[model samples]
Target: MKRKTHSVLRSRSGASITFALLLFLVCAVVGALVLTAGSAAAGRVSNLAQSDQRYYNVTSAAGLLADELSGKKVTIVRTREITTKTVTEYKVNLAGGAAVNANKIAETSSARYTTKLNERPEVPTELADYPTDTNDGAVFTDLTFLDTIAVKLLLDDANFNTDEAMNQSMKNGPEQKGVLRVLHAGSTDADPNVGVADPSSLSVDCLYVVQPDGTIILTLTNSTDKSGETYSLRIKLSPSINETESETTETLSSNRDSYTDSGFHETVTTRTTLTKTAEISWTVSGVEKVVSAADASAQPVETGTPIETDSP
Candidate 1:
């Protein structure tokens, strides 16, 4: 009986030993699986961090490119300030007068009747189409006896179309004398020859922004100092020039009561505005490409991918 009990106890001890070994093996396997999964997760997280950094840098570079293109899109704006005021022009004209030969100078040899009087002076283009509004009286009169009456009427018209006359006429005037030689002269509401007047000749600058159709947001702002290569923008601007001329006639009467002669006065008005618009039609420059080879190659070599052979 004692031997049998000893044998049973020995058997139980062996079975316990075997079960302990199996549990040890199972624990080791589980630990290995956990270690492998944790290592892979850590590697994936590290790679993601580097990818994010490289992505930001690349995005920044792309933004710089877009800005470079934007900067090239430049244009000129023109602006003009116009000053204008209405003014009353005063002039006195003497009518129906014949040249009474320089106080007894012979009519046949009068300087006023000289051949030089027949020669007309050449005028600028602005004034070529416009002629004087007033008529100079003829050398001879109907009444033979009255020919000796009008004051020598020495015509001094050299200053008539000069700048001095133009500027002076703008100011106070009784301002002129002798178409008919009335002392106070006469008053005309408007200048008959205003038609040849200079045009507005004004310009203004305006900003044009191309319509934003795609709604592309420039999340990043970038710029370059390099003067971009010259290129033309096929953009168009509405440039135009317009000119106008108008004339009106009114009855003329001497302010002085002594004269009751009926005559017509002419008023000419002209306007011109000047601007050079052909500039836009030519070269509208903008850089083609600004990024240099060095710039592109300078990116971090291992930023997105870690190729370290020693990574555990």
Candidate 2:
């Protein structure tokens, strides 16, 4: 009976040792898996931080270059590698100015003049006829001015080529006779107002006068008022000349890409590029000066016409 009891005790001791070994093996496997997951998460966070830093460095460098080039008339190319992770590059070009084209200038100027007339209010019928007493020195007596009056000198060319045609057209006045009409405000009809002057009686001297020296003159006179009132009308001309001058600036661009290896079998690539341009314009006012395509940048330059008002 003593031998049997000892055998049972030894068997129970062996079973306990086997169960403890299996439990220890399972815990070791779970610990290794947790360590692997932690390492992967740390690597991902490191890559993200590096990428964000690279992006910021590239953008900041580009902005600095752009600010330095503003309003400067120069052409240059520059490249910089801030670090292994960031690169930046830029190119700038200063385009030179040229005289405005002739045909374009004429078309643009005519269109602008027509547009101005269309936008103005119609003059009253009472003011249409010239005063019988030219000695009084007033175009209209006791006139109710309904709209601001404007006058502009135009270069007329039949084929827009021959000097003779241009001279004849200028001397004879525009192809279409200058007609004054009485228009009601805000009317869109084709014939919104009645013609105030006899077509044959309309004279170039009343609106525009051309000189033998190729200088055109515009005049506005009103002496009939008891107050003897006079006015200065805002005038705009050479629409094409303005647009062509504005387009003198030109823009150019370029791009480049590079790559470098990061640790852990990873690679990082960066791309950088830049574009820059320059601009110039010309302006002229009054009919005394001629703005030909050959001499677009003439003297007595103006940036643009002043805003028009009806008060005068």
Candidate 3:
């Protein structure tokens, strides 16, 4: 009986050891599964963060490019390239008065990423079609009388064409007779026949003269008109008389520091071209004239052959 009891106790001890060994094996498997799942979650988070950072960088650069090219009438192209564990490229194009287009290309061992961006300028709601004009008279007027009027006749003391006449006319007598005279009163559509007016007949303070070369000369007898009055004459002419055109090209480049964590490196290049054009236009009198800034210099008087006024 004693021997049988001892054998039973030994069997129980072996069974306990087996159970402990099974439990340890089960714990080891659970620990391994937990570790694997944690590692996978961390990797997914890292990839998501990297993707967001890359997108931000690309879009930031593109936004700056758009701002620089806005309201500019030119063509520009910008490019960027990166070669590492993954290959990446970017391109941006801007055309005169057109929208901006951006493209991104990325190649990696696992996947490829491509994106496109289109940005356009917004149309202004309040834009003026025609500039404001200050002149209150007819758009087209004749200035031929100026050529026939004698410079000495204009300076005659007997006439009220002086600065004092302008002031007295403002205060008294027939609205200051002959403050302004219309010579030919021609239109922008067609040229009118030259008509000479008698200097004796012109009582106004201002004279409009037309030159054979299609130049318009304005003479103001009163110095006050220069300081006080604003003329509202619109002349569309070319600037070729005084201005010349030019063109130029420029190149720009940059390099970005590598992102150690993301393993990204990039280099950017940009090329720009600038072109200038001359402004030219035909005058209302159907004559080619140089459009210049207002000059106060006295014009040369017509010489020889006094013109006789047509008999009424």
Best by lDDT: 3
- lDDT per residue for candidate 3 within 218-272, as digits (tens), equals 3333222212322222121111111132334333455554444323344544332
Q: lDDT values of the candidates? A: 0.26, 0.27, 0.30
Which candidate number would show the highest TM-score if scored against the true structure? 1
lDDT of 3 at 70: 26
| Order by TM-score, highest first | 1, 2, 3
What ordering of candidates by lDDT runs from best to worst?
Answer: 3, 2, 1
lDDT of 2: 0.27
RMSD of each: 29.7, 41.1, 47.0
Candidates 2 and 3 compared by lDDT, better number: 3
**lDDT tens string, model 2, 1-312?**
899988886775567768888999988999999999999999989766544433332233223322332222211111111111212322212243333221111110000001112223322111111222111111222321111111111222222112221122212333222222222233344773664223222111113322332222223222222232222221212211111101121222222333222111112233222111111111213322222423322232244444332221
lDDT of 1 by residue, 102-205 (tens): 12111111001110111222121123222322223323223221111111111224433322222221112221111111021223436656442121111111
Q: What lDDT score goes with residue 172 in model 2? A: 31
Which of the predicted structures, 1 or 2, would earn the higher lDDT when compared with the native? 2
The alpha-carbon lDDT assigned to residue 64 of candidate 2 equals 34
